[model samples]
Target chain A: MTDPRLLPRTIAVLGCGGLGVPAAWTLALDGRYPLVLIDDDCVELSNLHRQVLYATAEVGQPKAPALARALLEVAPQLQVEVRQGRLGPANAAALLQGCDAVLEGTDDAVSKFAVNDWAVGAPAGVQRVASIAAAIGRRGQWMVVRSAGPCYRCLFEEPPQPESLATCQIAGVLGPAVGQVGALAARSLLRVLAGEADSADGALVRLQARGLLRTPVAAAAACRCQARGDGAADSEPWGQHV
Target chain B: MFERDPKQLFDRYGRQLLVQGVQFEGQQVLHRLAVVVGCDGSPLAQAAGQVAARYLVGAGVGRAVVPQGGGTLLQQLDPLLQLAELPSEAQPPVVQLWFAARAYGASADVVWTDLSPQGPRQVRAGALQWWVGGPAPLTDAVALGAAVADLVVADALGVEPLPSLAVLDFSDPLAPRTRKHAAAAGPPLALPADPGSPLQELASKLSETLQIQQIVAAESARCYPAEACGLVVADADGQLVALAVANLQDHWHSQDPEAFSRSARTAFALDERAIAAQQRLGRRLVAIWHSHCDVGADFSAADVSGAYPNGEALYPGVAHWVVSVRRGCVAEQRVFGLEGGQLCYADVAVSGELAGRSGVEGRC
Candidate 1:
């Protein structure tokens, strides 16, 4: 039997775009956890390709509520909480306070790192693990982060300047590229929630143009995730504690 | 962007146009190609097919040949993506994406003909297999479908060379592996055939196997440290009865360990004379049941070879049941049979009562 504490009761999805749509749908199909959808952006005609939830009718609508209504149509009995708000440093903690796990699919790199920091520094009472994913053109990458393994910052060091990176809009992302990354993100979070985090953590999974590559990620010497704070004891509930 | 309808194309595919290789030339190429997404109507395959189709259409592909009457949402996906029931017989460059359900999980294959000016030469193809455990078929479908779509879009746009095969092994939920093998002399890509299942026909009679289950479990526990073998046959009255046969694995191993490397504890071999005698008595052989000392009730590769040598079934309709004996007690039992020329399994739970005394064992 799985430990009740190990199972996530509530999951918070940080983006309702290409990645968030499929991730939330997969989680909703699992029917084990109630989802909290968060995104302030509105649907657009261009998003219909990659983001499976929205149609042309819902193009001008806010993403979170529209996605919630779409998921409800698939599973009328599903419990879906919608939050039409972007997750930034100001509201990241409050928006994700009760969520046991976070699936971050937002296109913003800074926001991805912010979610990572918040999850790594979360208080002991709150169980938090973040799966951050991004894709551009024909390639994508995703990673699972928790207290026990290398966090997002440990692998990438720091978020690149917004000017340095080509946004999905600028470089253009294939629908399947981003969708696969989102599905993998959801798979990673589900693994962490099931108390099977060894494979999910400590690695960066890249869906390259050639093939899928999973490379081990080492924690930086000065990385904040290396600090054995109150989060270190989190291994107890996950059955990883020595 | 074409000078005739730049605004409309820009409105829908402006983002993808900004991509490196897919600038203006690739977009024109995509618009001329037709992709066919095939599904076998299983819930998992259809869902995956829709996912792949949506990606191809979204990338501004000119036309899509998909299964008709199911993709109402796909029609709403894009107006430029002409949904067709069949591609024209003309020599247009076409890509094929096939979603199939296997015994373990599911598989997707993408085959595209590169019709350059030279000619439609050898077709380039790639395959993706997602092997999953548990009831998370939806997640695997999403991942598998999206991966297939990536292969099509990337190959169409000339982004990079595609790997011959990619396998996602989620059988071990704790540690899933993503293996990408280099191109080799693999079997040619073909449409997946829907083969008839003999396993389902055999499994329908599970309720009548209660007495036979008890006998097999008892015989298995008593024959611990050496594999127990038997044949389920009908008597003169056409009633099912268990006939325990001595496993020749131990005898052969003792005589020639080098020739028969595995011990009797792990392997089982039947005596041809005992089987011939049973056939001579005019008994109908139904199944062959054996025990695995300390493993789960799974039809392993060796079990398949022992039953079907060189892809030929020893007995055409004989069902194979594997009993798992953990610590000298029958833990569980499962039925193994053929499906699509592959070994598949059906699980059965048995409340086995461990017996002590040894029973009659037929020898050569």
Candidate 2:
């Protein structure tokens, strides 16, 4: 059981759409620490359903502020910080500093990679303990970056080719499906926040309608992502987390 | 037990939950849940929607919201609650299913949905392995969704999502059972990535030319199961050439079966013939390349130790590249080297010749 009062878990949500909304909603409603919502987009007619934090009348309003307003109404005691902007290299470290975890809900390959690069690249010697969770399509995946595990870059160092990428416009996803992913991502992040040492370290868990699968991932030996090269040189590669 | 009660409808399931030692405030916990699922026309999603809603609704959950995704709206779905596809600058097949979040902070949100077919049925992201290909009838979205719902309801009411994954395969006689898989027994895969290196310039040149990547991809594919070994060198005309070398793991595995049960799949040893091959080609071994058929493209501890067996680079001024071959296809290709007592990787432009040209055409 994670006693929110004692842990003081603060989360920095990178986006406020489908995934971000539920994550924020759940965290705020749970009254768990301060919530920071970052996004430049606004609410629109099309976003009414899945982005649960906003209402119909709130359409055309900026999302970060709108979400903060909506969440505050439900969780007045909780602090909802809104950064009405996108996450770029310049502001990422600043916005992310001191946060316990980052929930990645961005819609493109570029931003996702940028977030991972920045998260793992947090100034050297500064133990970057932020865990990441994502709800893409119908799947929920998450990993914790630590000295003993793999970073987001270890799994995907490069972004997918532009033409190869899929968006909601192209490949439609169910509304509640993203919601499910959001919930799953939130749960995984909570586990990370709780310091659940019993949970597999750096193991990625994928959740779907039917079941969830977990696979252990390790940092590449020569990975440059500031996550490696600080220990005894283990002599083997495939099965052990290097 | 009331005969006509909704709890009766879930008598057997409820008993199963009880048997699993799920703690709750009796039935009040289930009734307090507010679940919202993302629904679409897909049979899997649609089926999953019905099953999950029924379980929560039947259990007396506060409300179960199913938002029809895509541009289309559900005909009779309460328009007030039907979820809409989020519109933003960048659109991707992202569906947000925030089940049980409506009560706000008063409740814990739980999600139960099927795998989306938008991306690879199976995806490997970081240390996470997400595979969606499951056997039919038993693992369909609807049945699985119900199991997940059971787990969530039980959990919100204060229970653990059982069986690690919390799957419900009603199609099976067991009705609800957790998935169990023996842990992959062996050492984990070692793959080092992007560290600053002096060989990066050379690595960039090789990668730009597609010489190293293409050859590594092709050889890794050519030699399945067993690790593939090769050397990348340039001809007099500056054309890159790749020579195949025997993995020799078969011999090593036989020598020490228990010590190296997975040697053929896990370890790799370059042949001594590499010296002769380099001399014949009149080219220095610019890079030592191998394939990881079972693991990813990163230098293993064995790789690092093998490179600097006696605490030094065996082939000075040369780089090492590893090809990650999954299911007989080249999944990733990375290059690495030892610089200043540290092992680091260099950027290999995978988009170069390695990606565009046919492996057969690039041979030699």
Candidate 3:
């Protein structure tokens, strides 16, 4: 098998909100992997505080294209593809086609799990890695899922009810707090690409009030990821990609 | 001797002002906070130096002193942050971020990251030390840079109490371990009052906790050689039940040896589904019980990170009982919990026998 690391990998970023904005920007600044930005939401006046990629003048513009333009303006060498649409199980494969990794930063619970399920369910030939991150009210958590480790569902079996948990819209969030998470997510992806996947994989890194706390997570036997055949068969020989 | 228009500052940093700690006074502290990024010839160090500088500027820090070649990206990232030269005379409370190896200095607080024989390590000193290590890779420089910036900001904002020393091992990145030492006297950060012993508190409050030692002892002995894990849940009747949740460590290690390097013999992973089922029982989770084979009954670093995942308690008000299983016999047991934001453990005498469901108490 060809060494996948030798090939230039494409990354698909889901959700262009607080976490995605900085994540996309950080990846663009790195200027290594080609990026595919997907988001149906438009730039809002309220998003400017935490979503640093958008400006006041760009309000009402689709987030994916606006972010692409913003990235190109700063680092013209970047290869960025814009897919302006909502991502679900149906279109996840098409939207993330030919991508080696996915950075899921969507705010809602449904979209996050959808991305997780899709990644965990990928076939042998199309095995891909993913990093899912969420931020709200001064705190955030990010985890990277690879074939060898636990999927997002393994840690959080299911998302809590909307009423039970407060979204950033309701509880409020600081710009720097989410911004820090976004950067962490982007850096984590870079680690995976740089052949240092351990630092970013399988563990959940929480951005707490004081410092970053990382907890190791394992696949639950009952979790679908554990029964996943593709995860075992298609997992690249470790260190080959590096 | 610093004066800036409050209206303009608010216009730029309005969202920051809304945060609790960064409300007017904290924002001023951040604005007054100066960080020095020391660079070296190494490419990794240079990249990390630049990442730290950019992050500090984006955070609305007042002034930054970057070694000449490093501030090129700072001006483009943010124009508000003033890039100044290193101070000549007595420095005033500046946090220094060193990307290369350096001896600890007395004057300024330091967030240091260096490549070591073991791996990449980060040390944050505000009268505290946090040493995090994993394999040495190029990304370590960038991760360390961001980590340093976070520590600097946390110190300025007083987000977390400073521990005298915290050793974080990422060798097994999947299951990282964090061990914290109590802060020394006269530390920069204020220490909160002691919350007292969690083991003693649990023993006194719950009669079952004291009586169920035999149940835990028998189970630990049964799961000998392989580490055992379970939960202590209170049913609707408010009766504490010892439920043996599957370890799942060996299962993961067998499936993915590269990621899960440790097996059931040395480590333990409680079933997430089991924990969630207990969580849904309306605040019935009293404590998570597990056995450490040959590792002693005291709470290990893994226990600390597992119980308080994300710096917040996974199960608030939940005490963790760690039983030591030595040579197929229960030697001792201890209870651990978070007290005043620190992991504190107390030894509990194994006494009393309770008749309950035996052998594989609950689902894996």
Candidate 4:
């Protein structure tokens, strides 16, 4: 007999690609929250398997709008807004303002690090912020970063090297892998909105397996997002200036 | 066919085996040699001769003289013939004779016999063939005989001898033997019959149980000025398997605006504990139930846009149920699933004491 009214909270999904789309959809559908679908990319055929929000017909369409449309069709009452742009330093500040929680689902290292820095630098009162780093190919790791705990930048000081970056185009990804991680992200977000602020804050959950059906591993102490509360200037940003 | 060791063959042949000067036809002599080595004189004997030739070529002595023969007698004559026919070149001719023993009938026991001057004399005997040749013909002949005797003794004692040269039998090339194995069958597995699916059953049970909890919360809303909350555990299919009511005495609520904020904060803390308790029971926190007395029996904008501390929306599910209590009767009860951040009505059907109240209802 938990409070039903405690459910619908504002959730923002950043990076509406393979991992982002399903997460946004689940949150909008399950948590019944108004979602902000964020991404700058257009739908590509390669994304068909993992990014379930888009159909073959929607290929070449902008991912944010297409995902919003798909989610609306499934759950017509959802307040799905599309932010058709990339999440970078340029708009990271304004975009993250007043958001109940922001999910960083971008695939790029720069974007990930940028989101991490932004979340940490934002005001302390901003309750929750989550980011998902999904690995590509037969096996992958999904890392969730939460706000009010540790920001993404607190964990890894620098962005991953170009050689280590795996893109959906080059390595290939399983659709269900993205789905599982996205579902986990949605579930974590729901729990956060439902007032399990401590569990949802600055937590990194990893789902590593071939199929999207496998369970994820949530790291207890891995979150650097929560450590942002110390407000110590001694901490390095990106481990280096730029 | 005798299997010959190419290293010993290279040592025996040294330099006398011709590769460039001798061409039997239009083809390069080495290519012709490769063809000759490819022949199947006898399966085992040809294998041995090929091994010997390959070893000699690999060792930089690019040519070898292959002799077709039987036991130790042929092995003895091979190097002698090679020395007699030694080519006149820049240096003394070092020739190696490879023995091919195809004519040694069924009783033919010896295949390859090594006759190198630097190492022990050894013979590969039995249905096996021997390759015996070296730079010094006399020494090679003597070693060949000793190797044959040793091979015979070893064979009688059931000790295995290594082959030195590979012999090729070029009789019928198309009839190669193939090996096969039978596949094993796996054991059968038992599966339980589906009374529908467990998930569906759980979902129905959960729906029913939540409906009852909703009724109680509605009654509490009528009696109290503040919102009411409860907790329940459902099985995999969403059936209400267990239920727990939060202690209202330990809880906080307020009628005033200033105190409302504090009450909301305290209620949030209790909500967290309830969620944790449900998780400990090994059940998903399927539904969160709360009452909205005069606020209407539908989700508020604040509720819809509210995010969990982790940033997930509150009612991200198939439905969010709201129960309104008016006076003494349940005035309005609605179930909703969010569609694009707006509340959409969901149908609910309950059994037992609430059987008559089951049907599609609008989001109040």
Best by lDDT: 1
> How accurately is candidate 4 docked according to DockQ?
0.01
Output the number of the DockQ-best candidate. Answer: 1
Candidate 2 C-alpha lDDT tens digits along A38-60: 89898765554346446556778
TM-score against truth, every candidate: 0.67, 0.41, 0.55, 0.37
For candidate 1, lDDT tens digit of each residue in A128-188? 7888888888678888877555778777877798899988778887777888889888887
Question: Candidate 2: misplaced stretches above 4 Å?
Answer: A1-9, A146-148, A198-201, A220-242, B1-364
TM-score per model (chain B): 0.50, 0.44, 0.43, 0.32
Instruction: List residue ranges in candidate 4 displaced over 4 A.
Output: A1-9, A197-203, A210-242, B1-187, B191-364
Candidate 3 lDDT at A101 equals: 82
Identify the superior model by lDDT, candidate 2 or candidate 4. 2
- Tally clashes: model 4: 104
Off by over 4 Å in 3: A5-8, A16-18, A21-32, A39-78, A146-149, A169-221, A224-242, B1-23, B66-78, B83-94, B101-135, B161-168, B178-364
Q: Mind giving the per-residue lDDT tens digits that candidate 3 earns over B1-364?
A: 2365767565555654555554455566667666776554455566556655555565567677766655555654454557776544214445565454211100112532223457654333432222222113333443445555555554455554444444333434455444445444322221211335555667554434554665676777688778888888878887777788889999999999999899999889888799788768764888888887644454555666676667788878888888765555554465777666655555454443422222233410
Clashing pairs in 3: none
Q: Evaluate all candidate structures by whole-model CA lDDT and list the values in order.
A: 0.71, 0.51, 0.63, 0.42
All candidates in order of lDDT, best leading? 1, 3, 2, 4
Candidate 3 is scored at a TM of: 0.55
CAPRI grade, predicted model 3: incorrect
